[model samples]
Target: MKTRNQKGLESKYWLLIIVAACILCMAATFFAGVKSGPVRVIADYTVVPMQKGINVIGTWVNGVADNFVTLKSVQKENKTLKEQNANLKMENNQLQQKAVELERFYDLYKMDQNTSDYPKVGARVIANDGSNWFTSFTIDKGSADGIREDMNVLSGNGLVGIVTKVNAHSSTVRSIIDEVNISSMIMTTFDQCIVSGDLKLINNGVVKFEQLANNENEVAVGEQIVTSNISSKYLQGLLIGYVSEVNVDSNNLTRSGYIIPAVDFKKLQEVLVITTTKQDLIDNGNQTQSDSSEK
Candidate 1:
């Protein structure tokens, strides 16, 4: 530290000597006038450029300081906007979840209204076979809830399937799209047909329909088909599906087609079970099961 102080003092002493020398040179120039030609020329060339270089360096330093201040302000604003964006994303996710739940409740209400006449048991789908079809799935309700074999199951819009197996707490439903199932349906014009499940077509949201009476009755596309009055397991007037394709066979005795089912099997989550069984129909009740055979 002491050495540093001594060096600084020596630097000040040299600066004073340089100033004294400059003053003497100016005095000589004033006395000799233009006659001090070479000295004056040299000073003008060296000093003016040096002073201009110093001014340029000072301007660059000032510019750098101003830019640093502006950069800080921009960084602060960017941080604030990033926080707000994160908050907005979180809020949007919550709203989307609420929307899905609300839609589920609305569907439940519609199913209740459609099956108001029957004393029904509501069940939530708990397990699936993970196949491309809703051929077999387990529900939250079972024998304890009065769910029995061959009981007709319905979804929001129409019939779904029949209960095949029941446990103490849950029941398994074999959806109408199952390959082993068949249904008897009647068109709006009272024309009869046999609807059967086809594994190949279930993935496409349609079932197979055949044995349609080939009469003057026209089975057009989009015509609604419901459980026939003569059905033994399914209730009459319960919508099964809509006619999608219709064509007369080579024999000309019957027409065959595809039907788009009323239940969106892929989206099944909750279902309703009609408390009344097929025996109820045989015992003079309204609903009955289908006993149709494949064509």
Candidate 2:
């Protein structure tokens, strides 16, 4: 009983000492806090870094979202531009085709106006015989279009050729440059001569005029050559060519020269046909009637 009492008293004393120490430590902590003036809680360092981080995250997310929206808008604009370009190309092609058709119609209208009196027919040149001796071209119009042999063919400028043969759908034109054709002429001077076709020297688009009246004096260059009034086939005063060169014999009895043809045979495209039988008479009558009316 006495030992038990002593142990209990010792245990009570240690418990009291531990309680007192804990109380003293708590008091010291309180005193230190007071001395430090409530610890002056400074949020400047920690709170500022957290706020900056939030701002950076928000800015990054906003930038990404804006970029995505801008990209989508650009793609849509590109697609629209592509479609507009395609539409413009289609419109341009249509306009080009219309312009071509209008040009063809204008050509046809002009041709019609030119051949009002004559029973004329417009024909397109289909093929050319690649020979200087023959010098013929095929036209699209033939017997079906009232085309016949010996019909005079004229281009927009002047006479082109004569129809020699006709097929069902096409006709052949014998150009004036052929060797078989002859163009008679009276000199612009006081001399009379005949211009004959020679295919040998026709490479330079000229012909030889033989049996000139005044062969003693050489013919001057640049003199105009026209179809003679006595020509059985061709009309008078039709411009044949220009005098380029003159060759005279030693005895001065006969002379020949080069004549550059008026028409460029290589570029022949559209032509007119003189189908009227009394075309010359009709032309003269009209001129006379006009003169009478004017008077």
Candidate 3:
């Protein structure tokens, strides 16, 4: 039953005694040295083991800290390398696309040099309405670029379609593979025929041609077909396709056949618009209605 002040004094006195004992032990160790005697034996059994344990703990902690620093550096380097790889892949893709575009331009150049020599505006296919066929699609050029409705659109190889709709900045081309699209084509011998689109035939990459003159016209499987002089809408002599199959109808009056189109409808990426329309030629007195009359 001691008072609060009495208990506090007892605690202080015990703390001083412990401190004095600790100082005496430290001074004894300093004077006695650790190389020999009972003092050394006491150090080995007590302070030496404690110091060894502390050194072991410090070594482990330092190793852990160093490992964390190395891990952080490795993660940062990996992130930087991944970003560089992605950027390089993007650059390679861009270069490949540019090369493809350049090749297409060269093809168009050759076509322009060999054919009608008419003025043309080159346009890229911006969008396609059909998935498996080029029945209809939009171009990047339009009226503002001198493109007009019914203007004959040609690819690198031959006829692609005609511009059907035009806006200020873009135009829609109705491809020859469209159901309603038709072309008057003539064989090498001036034998006239009608080339029309059929969804069934186009699925096979060919189109229907009929009314081939039955005079034993001798149309072969590989004969070339071109836009006829009788086509009022299309420019004459534009390559249509090559005759693929030929057979006289049951009536034995006219031959019906199919032609593989000169232009690959499924791969239409760019086209050339012949700015000189058939109507334009007729207006300029370069063509006659008699020549463009439907056969």
Candidate 4:
């Protein structure tokens, strides 16, 4: 709406301000100090404040860049540490398993030496009765390997159980701690005793035994107990366990006690099966007696 003269005046004013700003920028390269009054005032409000704003923006940008780099480095380090921790745990578990395996093998060797009179076959336990302790289990070897029902099973320096069922490919064993009859004898006195399993008391790592003659009092705590020669199914002289407790019955003629089983049922893995049964020995003895009578 203004006339040409008015518009021309306004253009001249803007051109002057631009020229002054350019002159001030060029002067900054050569002069470090401003001594003039008008120039100082203009720089204080305009150029100086603009420089301060630019400095603030640059400092903020630099801080943001540094913080981003630090965050990335921290995340990478955490990931690496977590991976290393997982690997160490896996290695430790493997080492522990190897140690357990070695211990089991050594125990088996000692047991074999103790019962060197019998021919034996080795078998690996395949499955258990779903309890913490292996009260009953199946093995990988069976009829194909000469395994049969009533074959005595051994592990961890003593008797484990007897085979109750046999298949061509696998067999089932009922541990002494299972609900089965066990005929045992004291090694020192050869006194006969009856043994059986109680599921409730087996949690304490022991089984029930009775009919030890109270008159003898010969069976003391810690006495070695083994399968009796008169057992109908299991072979004789296979170590069963050690006596843990003994008490005379109310009738006063018999004593009953608990036996701490030698095998760690919770950790059983491999076992030895005696190929001979008590019935085989009994038949052999009968044959020898008959031959002697004829002679």
Candidate 5:
């Protein structure tokens, strides 16, 4: 039996001997004029196939490298497109927000023009109870900005509420639809009545009014109801709502009905605070009356 090192050495010697034989054969064919024999057959069968295999492997390697480059480029382009799409979505959202803000401002402008006769201040509603409606909410303005308790708050072409609580920089308004508020109002026909704010009635999109002086009165549905001239806290003639349904009570002593509020409490956002209280109007009226009598 041969050792491992002796076997490896014999294998190396045999490989060298084969290489030397092939070289000698090529030399004989080229320079010694030995053509068209076993040497020619050896080159055709062995050397030609070896060269072809090397060329095929080189081509395959080049093709794989090119495919890898193309794949990387496609991935880069896809990533760039994703980034562009995200940025476009962000821009579209910003534009939509701006448009909504612009429309709100335009509506505020219209409200301001409608009540231009009074000394008023514009205020934004900032906070509210976690309900779906603005039943009672806080405004951004307060006593520091001349906001006072009982100051009338208006929105969307009609009266919304009155400031009930005031802080240094914020105030809470109690909407006319708030359950605690009982508004004194007058109809276009000069009939006086009391408006009640009920939670159940608000869900039906109207407030309750009862104690109509005349059940036989010609006040019909769709009659416009405004703040009465006699209301102490709420200024007179500010639109409250329109009459929706009228019915006689069981006692038949009075008539009760519903008024669809002019201001949509659910969509209430901004308001115009008539800075002057109802007391101010009364004072000015009395002062004028006194002056006229003296004259």
Candidate 6:
């Protein structure tokens, strides 16, 4: 009986301790709830560090959003610049082509203006043989176009030279300024002269003119000279050059002068070939005479 009574007493004491602990837990929870209106407390810690962490996280997210927006804007700008660059390149190419076409048209106009008298066939110079003493150039037209040897070759400005050789599709022209070319001439005043191409004289941009006939009037400076009617090679009245200086031989009637050629040989580009046959010349002359008689 005594033992049973002792056990009952111990059980009752344990139940009371549990009840006390439950009450203390409820009191603590009530106090914590009341203080959580503006400041929360768990055990002995406050919520300040958690609030700071939330603020830092929000700022980082906003920064990431701004960076993404900047990157997209840069990509858009890059695409636009690329398109503009391509357009500019296309425009530049078109302008260059236009410039080339204009230059070709100018050359054609010049060629037309220079060959108004003769029925001319225009040809472009394809090659130049400047290394040889007998300097020559090859043209794009030949015998099929009625281009023959010894025919006159004139440039857009004035007389260039004469055709020296002809092929089926091309011809070579030997310029009057070539070392082998010699032309007989007469001064506008009163003297007959012969002009020869000396390489040294051409180096100085002049030709040597030697007077042939005896005359009282010496060849004067600044006198114009033309191809003589007696010349077997060239047509009459074609301008050779003006006399720059006249040097008379001692105890001789003959004199020599320097000739500045009418044509600028350095810039020669396009040339016209006069292919009218010699028989045509005779026919034309006879026709003119008949017409005159009728009149």
Candidate 3 TM-score versus the reference: 0.72
Which prediction has the highest lDDT against the true structure? 4
Candidate No. with top TM-score: 4
Segments in model 1 whose C-alpha atoms lie over 4 Å from true places: 1-73, 76-80, 281-295
Worst 10 contiguous positions by lDDT, candidate 4: 28-37
User: What's model 2's lDDT at 57?
Assistant: 100
- Greater-TM-score candidate between 1 and 5: 5
| Pairs in clash, predicted candidate 3 | none
Question: What is the descending TM-score order?
Answer: 4, 5, 3, 1, 6, 2
Error of 1 at 96 (Å): 3.6
Model 2 regions lying over 4 Å from their true place: 1-119, 130-134, 186-208, 215-222, 247-249, 276-295
Cα lDDT of model 3 overall? 0.85
lDDT winner between 1 and 4, please give it: 4
Each prediction's TM-score against the native? Answer: 0.70, 0.52, 0.72, 0.78, 0.76, 0.57
Query: Which RMSD does model 5 reach against the true structure?
Result: 4.9
Q: Is candidate 3 or candidate 4 better by lDDT?
A: 4
Which residue runs does candidate 5 get wrong by more than 4 Å? 1-63, 180-190, 213-223, 250-254
Per-residue lDDT of model 5, residues 83-199, tens digit only: 999999999999998998788778778877877888889899998987988999999998889999989999856888888999999999999888754545556577888888887
**How well is each residue in 4-53 modelled by candidate 6, as lDDT tens digits?**
99999999999999999778666554555564543346522433454467
Model 1, span 167-250: residue lDDT tens? 999999988888754556665688877888887897777888898878998777899988876676777677888888898988
Pairs clashing within candidate 4: none
What would you estimate as the lDDT of candidate 1? Answer: 0.81
Model 2 lDDT tens row, 110-162: 64575565567788888899754447999999888888887777665445667
